[model samples]
Target: MTTTVVGVDGSPDSDLAVEWAAADAARRHRPLHIVHAYLSPFVAAQVAVPTSGGFEPVLRAAAEGTLGAAVARASSVAAGLDITTDMPAGEAPAALLDAARRAALLVVGCGHAAMAGLLPGSVSRAAVHHAACSVAVVK
Candidate 1:
């Protein structure tokens, strides 16, 4: 079945997006897929340090928490909604675009409008232009 894909990052904007996506999914009787892309500090640093004890676990935990919370919120917003979460390791836009490939709609949130000549945020703009499905930017 076609799904509604949303990108969440534990931000207020992301929360709004999740709610909007959930409502859309409910209206359309579709499943909702929430994704959060996390970049490991080690990978971001591009340096191979001792893996004995690092912040990787903390980062992963935080990402998991974010996804969980987002799922909860979506579930509450739309009872019986088939909601799922994915924590991909990479850039947000890339991860979102990948999820959108099989989605019927992709939803994202924007805090504010961009400059006259520019799009809102990189993720939203990129998804709007590259996603395989229609994209919605909730303000």
Candidate 2:
């Protein structure tokens, strides 16, 4: 069955998004797809100099680890919730939106748009505007 996708980045609003997504998935009787994409600082740190050794391997590992942790976190909140995780090698918003395209719902933290919870970044906004399915920004 089609599932719901939620993006997590270890923030308060992301936690709320996870809970909300879990409930929504339960209500819909569909699996929940929790996604988390992570990259190393040496890959593309804004304030730090990029490493010269390359970053593809480190980035892939970090993304895998982040996605695994996100799944574990979701399971801790709602055990046996049938959540499948995806860790794509890309920006969080882009990967999330990609997952959302196949999802019944896309959940993320509320961006600081004076509409809902104040997320500290613009990733949520990008996902909300570009998501192919219903977007829910949990407060």
Candidate 3:
């Protein structure tokens, strides 16, 4: 069966997307694949904090935690549903699009309307426009 793929970042909207994707995967009788893309510490440190030897491990741990929470949330929504997770080594939109190549549907979360005017976030917008499969932007 074609799997349902969802992107998560630990935000409230991401939680909603996880719930929606879990339910959809259950209804479709397909597996749910959760993806959380994180940048390399070298790149992330440039954008987030000062470069340090300890930063990489923290980034990896945070990404794993995000995936774990998403898995738990999805499981709560659909008990007994098959679920898998990934932490791809790249940007969010590209990773999601790559994963979507083998997916039945790609799901992403949309933050508050004020955050991006009338459009969805960059990752969601990219998926909505570029994913080979159907895309869902859950708010």
- Model 2 TM: 0.74
Model 3 TM-score (2 dp): 0.86
Can you give the lDDT of residue 30 in candidate 1? Answer: 98
Poorest lDDT segment (10 consecutive residues) of candidate 1: 111-120
Model 3 clash pairs?
none
Residue-by-residue lDDT tens digits, candidate 3, 1-139: 8999998878899899999999999999999999987554336545564445555567778889989999999999999999999998667778889999999999999864221222348778899999999999998
What does the lDDT read for residue 16 in candidate 1?
95
Q: Each model's TM-score?
A: 0.86, 0.74, 0.86
Q: Can you write out model 2's per-residue Cα lDDT over 3-84, one digit (the tens) per residue?
A: 8899876666777788888877877888999887655232354434233345556656666765676777777767778988
Error of 3 at 50 (Å): 12
lDDT of 1 at 3: 98
Error of 3 at 98 (Å): 0.4
List the candidates ranked by lDDT, beginning with the highest: 3, 1, 2
Candidate 3 has an lDDT of 0.84
Ranking by TM-score: 3, 1, 2
